[model samples]
Target chain A: MQTSTHANPRALRDIEMALERTKAEIPVLTPMVTAFGPLLAERFRLREAASGWVGPLPVVDAERFSQGVFVLADSGFQDMSAHLSEAAHGLLPIMANSFPAMAQELNTLIAAMDNGALTMDALAAAGFGEAFTVPGVNAETMDFAVAELVRPFVERQAQDLAKLVRDLPWRQTICPICGGTPNMSVLRRIRNDSEFIQAHGGRRFLRCSCCATEWTHKRISCPSCGCEEPDELVVLSDPSRPFERADACHRCKTFLLCLDTGELADIPDPDVAALTMLPLAHQARRQGFVPLAEHPWGGL
Target chain B: MPKAIFIDTTRCTACRGCQVACKEWKNFPAVPTKQRGTHQNPPDLTHYNFKLVRFSEHLEGDVVQWYFFPDQCRHCLEPPCKEASTVDGAIIRDDATGAVIYTEKSSKEDLETVRSACPYNIPRQDPVTKRLVKCDMCIDRVRANLLPMCVKSCAMGAMNFGNREDMLKLAGERLEAVKKEFPKASLLNQDDVSVIYLVADLPAKYHEFAVAGVSGSMTRKQMLARIFAPVRKIGQQVRG
Candidate 1:
């Protein structure tokens, strides 16, 4: 569940591997998971390729970064055509499988991008957070799909520059790389230098909602409002599945679903891991705790 | 502080849910049994049954008073069984939770000596592996921030698990309330053991091994200290 922000080609394999493992581990999710497998694998392929080719994004300003400013929040990933075209090509067919009713609309969107009549940057400016002229696609689905498409470029930039700001404690609830809020929290296993285990992991790392960047966060603090009271933070989990959990903050009435990678047999890709905790997310919402951010498969 | 369990016997309905839950948690198979003409099944702790609810009946004038005691490892504050272990890592006391855990290496130790050292007579050795097996306070569940199986399964609110401080505070609050009805009510050896039981009546009325035996009135730590004094002195002298 602790998918590091390394956009190496192995991720292409890991995403599919995680999907297969998830199918084997929780057969109940196989049908829903099988449908999205190609889309996710293709996304990871773009991300790996972007890691090698896509670059020259703005470098982080250390002064602004220390003051809780995000690297690419203001100056967004420019000239989105290079990254967006291939992402759309790989995604449209897979999108067809999931959205058969919207096949006509999907084709329209596909043609617009292919012929350069419609650009992703133009779509971001005009359509995002507002009603889209592109017919038939729901706002939430559009947002989710756009986020998925743009993720590879953002992630590659974050991966390339992670070492520069690794040690500097931001203490902010959002991702330093893309100024994105966390979709989920992960308790990463901390390995010691020697043979003997110095400590067992409780280290909390928040995985970005947009770019897949992981940043250290206060374990007791609420991601929504930054409440630090231990009493306010309530842990909800199924005893049978100790790996999955939701940390509910009573103060803000918000919860973030979490995966303890230490308990899992394999380190699942972040997107795949969040899908596995669909039940926990439902449980959290049922308890009247709002999720900080939804995964790309928001409606599902 | 280490973890602790507070058992309020006053609230226990003798449902034996805890007993069944312990067996389920350990994944221990059922043993052959015949009706012994009592509600309590598997009457005592065995290799399979680490927890057993004892049903004791007493006649007070014309009234028949029944007391149910859920017996398991006390996980003593300073476990003498740990000192009695001859093999290293056999009887490990987890520093984090103070859980008296018997590992696979426990097979190397003399079962008699280690078992005898425990005031509660809780340790039961496996015939095949020879390792002492008992309630580990479900350390696996505790570490995962889940309630122990016995505590989780209890519907009567008789069992409570938490930090040692919290459990002690709860035991005191429960003891005060129970004392209003049953005057002889007390939290038994709360300081000496992590598993604090609030009994409604005299400790012996519940079980003989309730608060350690009458002959062995001293706490297990004190007894171990007395027995191992000579060995400690010799070791100190040898070091010097």
Candidate 2:
């Protein structure tokens, strides 16, 4: 095992404290569990696009790079090809934007990979890349690229929040710390576990980047146009997950994806977790709705 | 009306959302790249990657300064690339978005000359097509009343686009606020280019050539040609 050579005294102290915390919390964060266990049992479902669909999700044809999923593993042109899948890649990119720093990291990783500067192993080790257990090269490639682009953006965004916010502001969508846009207009990622809540978890939401400030955008309020009009705000859902829906603001012709995690046993990765709702955005876009926020990994 | 992009480095988190979004929106295919140790992927601007978030980190005293420069074409007010390339319609200024567009006609000109003329060192040529390319400020999206994909996908408020007057106003307000925190904050090429950069530190700290340079004088013959070419062309037409 290699040790980090952080020479800066303050940074080293911070790292030591963080390591202690991680060691103490390991039992909670890494509870022994089988892959695809009780965590996914509550709402593990898949929804496919309908015939003749003309929405945000692309129709399957020569461009159906993967079966119901867009992969960019060996894609010569990863960005251009990744969005072919309506349900998978379509939603991932928008959700990835929820963390701008991660999005940037992912973009760099992708560029590095294309330039042969990054390898699959290096990416996974640094937590900037992932390999899907999917069958074909296309599926794996797409998943790798998506993960590569998203992870760094997420970590860096969180890091910036910790360092930048001296006194967290009240009402705004942009991240005051870094004037970056957030893809998801989070109402709140409420922790159902009382133990976690006691660990300083509170109701904090994400913001869009155009103006840098994070406000309490209401859970039900349309993220686009700040429209609270019930009639103008349309929620689209499928049977796969009733809790998550695409909230489209008719007034602004923009849409936001929202997840109600109050019902989950665990916190979800908003980027990949939002994949189940891809059909809704596809349906909405076909109806002439533009996405107020887009995903970095998933697009079509 | 030529289009432009105003980048405020203070707002950038080195997120490459604009880069990916630009590729996605433009339907440009991804080029194969390898990790070169830096976060900057693909190394340099190519035919595919138009907008790149450049990263540079330095230590100034106790503060470890890490700078993010989202680099692209400056689209100079009076473009030197256009002046260097005499091929008709090679590079044009779009009336709608004020975008400097490089058409197929650019293939007729010498790529080296056009590339050298750019003060910002923008304009990459496709080896196969022999045409120059750079940021077009998402002109198609502008025409449709949609913000450029890069601007829209920017989760960081680093990239801003709008009417020149409005962007300038916003830039001014931001500059004032940034100055309170960074006394050295200043706008780059505010008057000479469409793409204005509001840098929080010395521009060089952000990226090499983050601002236009007057580092060297042109050679006597080259300088004379540039200075007298316009007058001579006009005189020849008048005499003819």
Candidate 3:
């Protein structure tokens, strides 16, 4: 059984505000925002398609679980692939004029996905790797495009799976919902009710870049290397934006940007917050540490 | 496989690039000091300074010989300082980089006990933060697939960092070549620690604690404390 909570209107408002703010803030990202705006608008449609679909929950073996498996097989995405492919096609304008061949390839790929002939292996076999290498279209940009398309459906699936596994022990750094590494972390004051008093305490949760799943993680441990030593960990922040900081692991030389939602007057979408924190990623790189996951803006 | 750093002292020219680079990378402010009459400034390692290149001179066979020892944490394979830490997360060895890190929680630990347990006398306490500090092997740079600041800044190729096996191989090759001139050339505590030093003369000539077995200064109580530390930690966790 799944408990349904009403969607917060403020979160949608935050995403809209962020989309507008990002365009004005970073001039270099204008083209990306222009390309992604329409695709993001299609998320509700994809979510509708995902909600109407029915499938059994994935069964993962212990070995696969340890290896960070969330989606068990290619069949899991069969029901929602058409909607995802339609989303992928919506980004065709960004690709068509610059690289006709790549756009043509994407068209074929989308058609194949719609036809149930585009499993991951089939997509690989259909020269997706070669298509992504086209001029002005690299792996990172291609990843962003695909993620924008599939995220809505993947997120819905993840939510349903998350409901079933709420009580299971998952200690790994990877997201238990979608098996994706975290691109950002959230530091929020979680409400607690004990005795007769209500209180709040700071808790850290990692948000996945792929499916938007959030999982509780230890506050002190490095998500990358699992180094619990407090001295080896350092939190760096831009002097101007103290609310956004990078939790760096000196031991592993890796960092993950964290957003203190508690500090925000208006909470921003976590995905949009990731875009705003590109400067933090560059700062972490300047200090000789890699981001746990690559940001869409490529700073990570 | 664990990572390690190999320092060939024979190739070092006492340029102090490694020392300066460490301070630069860590953003450590310079310590104020009077002239100590030697090239080594600040006299000894402090909380701010994690790496220090020590200079020593001795007369051997009526000839003046100078030994330059770039002193830092050895990052022992089984760190005694970690064993001595009573406070949780005061000290921990990084599983990926093999760095023995002194965390901010060290402020809650007995500094003397943690300091005395180190066979190499590496940890230093900050007067302001009340936290113990030392070399963390430049793990940040290492994890980014770059050499440690000290190794990167070394122009003489005396400092090298890589996998344990590759460093041991380099140490062995350097030792073989150095042995042609100095028969006593050897790698110091290579098996016991991550930082392997290739010294052309006796290990003591480089630094007092360059080799592990040579030091018997650790008190019997410290030894016993280290031996039973793991058991005590488990018992405490269970009790809690």
How far does residue B158 in candidate 3 sit from its true spot (Å)? 0.9
Q: Which stretches in model 1 have alpha-carbon errors above 4 Å?
A: A1-3, A51-59, A120-132, A135-141, A194-197, B1-240
Candidate 1 lDDT by residue in tens digits, B133-231: 999989887664556888866666687777788789888988887789899998878888889999999998999889865332555644774497457
Give the winner by lDDT: 1 or 3: 1
Clashing residue pairs, candidate 3? A231-B103
lDDT of 3 by residue, A118-185 (tens): 55443332222234333344455555456555567667776666665555556678877656789888
Q: Which scores higher on DockQ, 1 or 3?
A: 1
Model 1 vs truth, CA RMSD? 17.6
What would the per-residue lDDT of candidate 3 be over residues B1-240, giving only the tens digit for each residue? Answer: 488989888877888888999999999999998897888776889988888888889899999999999889999888888888877888999998788888888887667777778777788998999999999988776553346888767666677777787799889988997899899998887878899999999988877767775443444545866886777667756765
Indicate which candidate wins on DockQ.
1
Full ranking by TM-score: 1, 3, 2
Maximum-TM-score candidate: 1
The worst-scoring run of ten residues by lDDT in candidate 2 chain A lies at A42-51
Per-model DockQ against the true two-chain complex = 0.02, 0.01, 0.01
TM-scores, one per candidate: 0.54, 0.45, 0.45
The per-residue C-alpha lDDT of model 3 at residue B211 equals: 75
